[model samples]
Target: MRKLTLLIPILVIALIGVLSSVFVVDEREKALVLQFGQIKAVKEDPGLSFKIPLIQEVVKYDDRILSLDTETIEVTPSDDRRLVVDAFTRYRISDVVQFRQAVGVGGVRVAEDRLGSILNSQIREVLGADQVTSDTILSEDRRELMNRIRNQARDSARSLGIEVVDVRLKQTNLPEQNLNATFARMRAEREREAADEIARGNEAAQRVRALADRTVVETMSEAEREAQVIRGEADAKRNGIFAEAFGADPEFFAFYRSLQAYEKALQGSNSSMVMTPDSEFFDYLKSDRAAK
Candidate 1:
């Protein structure tokens, strides 16, 4: 019984040592075996790994792609216009050993902080170039600018064991204080355009109205000429008829003319004449044909 008790204690200690020496590295993780705070081995593959009992420790880091949102920053472009910029990056640890060596015990958080600084610096450099303008940053050319930033950051982050996969601008906006001013300027531009259109429309309307007035004047003149011609033709025809009657019978024509004169002189009931009876105006009234 005494020997069994001693064997049981030994077995228990052996079991604890075995359990502490064996470690696991999940498929989504990378591990570093540290002995006395010094890296001894790196485990990148999944399944099982081993470390010394009690003296060695394992530090695991995520192997998947990670994202970091950079702090919002303000930059000035070549045009002297300022913009507020926000961006994000996708990255992964390319060399865990290098990462551990660079970041030490601070781990992924320290690496991220350093990466953020690199991204911001590169962003400021690319955006502040003499040829880059605020319009370019807000336009499709922004994609090209982001690529440049990613390339620069990728090169810079290599010392930190970080591989920058992509970088993209999330927002590019005018500052809050500039929003109202920009809107006012836009409204003024629209108003000016509208005024120009109205002026053009008025000019066209005046031209059309002047043309209509000229057309009316021309039409009226043409109608007046036609009426004058008709009036002259009618007068000539009346005079020709009078001359034919006089040629056919002078005495009868004279009598008809005298009767027309009497009709005019006595057209009204109160019409009166003070002419002498022996006057030629009364010749037809006292002629011999009247007795017959």
Candidate 2:
């Protein structure tokens, strides 16, 4: 029974050792076997793997693509316009051996931090180039610029065993202070345009008013000229009638004229006129008295 108990303990230790020596890697992971802090093997496929128990250690990394979002950075384009840029990267560990060597025990977090710095540098370089402007950044050409940044970042990330699948600028904006200033300038421009429009309207109104006034003056002058012509014609017709009457009978015409003169001279009550008895104006009165 004692010998059996001793054998049982040995079997239990063996089982523990076996369990510790064997490790399983999932399809979504890549693992590195480190012996005394030195890489011994890289396991990429999903399956059971063997290593020395208590002497070797396995470090696992996600083989799938990962995302790293960089902090917002400031970039000035060729037009001297400054913008805050936010970017992100899609990457994966292509070479686990090199990745393990580069980052040591820091793992994916440290790798992403370093990669973010490279991405930020490339973003600034590409976006701040002489040919790039704020308009370009906000245009369809922005995709091409991001591709350039991705390519450059890929090159820089090679030493770290990182494959940059893509780099994209997520957002870009002006600073608060600049935004306010831009709004102010736009308002001023709008106001100036409004003033110009008002000036043009006033000028048009003045021209219309002047035209109307000229038309009125011409109409009034034409009316006055027509009235004068009508008055002159009427006066000529009346003088012709008077001449015909006078040619018909001089005495009757003279007597009629004298009666008109009397009526005009004695138009109001209590009116009197002093005249010589032989005056032609009194001829009618004298003849009437003599006949009676």
Candidate 3:
């Protein structure tokens, strides 16, 4: 009967012990104490804690950094070009008290939503100034844009008692419809340029060929005229030589001239001679034969 009574007291003490305290808090966590469903204290420390077990609840939160990926959204540049952008943000709780007061047991979903809204607004403003992005330009003034976003996020997160570590753009792309149109236009322009180049080349070739033909005709005509002049001069020289020889001795010149004429006029087997009385070819013949 005494042992049973001692056991009852020990059980009561064990139950009290179980209901009155908390285990050691992890070094990487922050805790919030709630009394009867009402928040009473925030504990940002590690190790064992004392609390009313049945009436107090301790909500723990991670003290490490967290990341949130924003949805891909369409943005327009200043030049009226539209593109899809995917972004992400990294943040951490700066004030345990404020996080507890504002977020309660929900952690940072609300906070993340609020930050996403702020980021979206700032991104819209930044992207509005970008019209068409150049393929060669990295991020297209993205550093300046990130700087603007960082400043905005700093101000925003500070107001929410959170610290923004970094925000980054993951991808940027043209919309499917826009890509199709852009590619088609580029193809058409390239084709037009190629055609123009071909036409210019053909024109140039025709000019060169026409000029070559003109040069050929001019050269051939000049050569033929020069040949005719040379031949005429040669004939005149030959005639002059003959005249000089004939004047040097009239009788001998007459005989040589008659032989040359006979050789030319009587070239065929069936031949006849006909001449005037004063003809040089008949000078070698008798005057009676000449008359006949």
- Per-residue lDDT tens digits for candidate 3, residues 1-292, read 9999999999998887775675567989888788866778878778888777767878877789889898888887765667888889888888877766666666688888888888888777766754435331135677667777767887877877788888887887888999999899999999999999999999999999999999999999999999999999999999898889878987678777778877888887889767676765555577664564
TM-score of each candidate? 0.87, 0.75, 0.68
Tens-digit lDDT track for model 2 on 6-116? 999999999999999999999999999999999999999999999999999999999999999999999999999899999999999999999988998999989999998
Candidate 3, poorest ten consecutive residues by summed lDDT: 129-138
RMSD of each: 3.0, 4.3, 5.4
Report the C-alpha displacement of residue 55, candidate 1, in angstroms. Answer: 1.0
Candidate 1 clashes: the total is 0
Backbone clashes, candidate 2: 0
What's the CA error at residue 272 for candidate 3, in Å?
12
Candidate 3, residue 18: how far the Cα is off, in Å: 6.0
Model 1 per-residue lDDT tens digits across residues 241-289: 9899899988889989999998888887787789776688877778565
TM-score, predicted candidate 2 vs. hidden true structure: 0.75
Please tell me which model should have the higher TM-score, number 2 or number 3: 2
**Distance from true location, Cα of 63 in model 3, Å:** 2.6
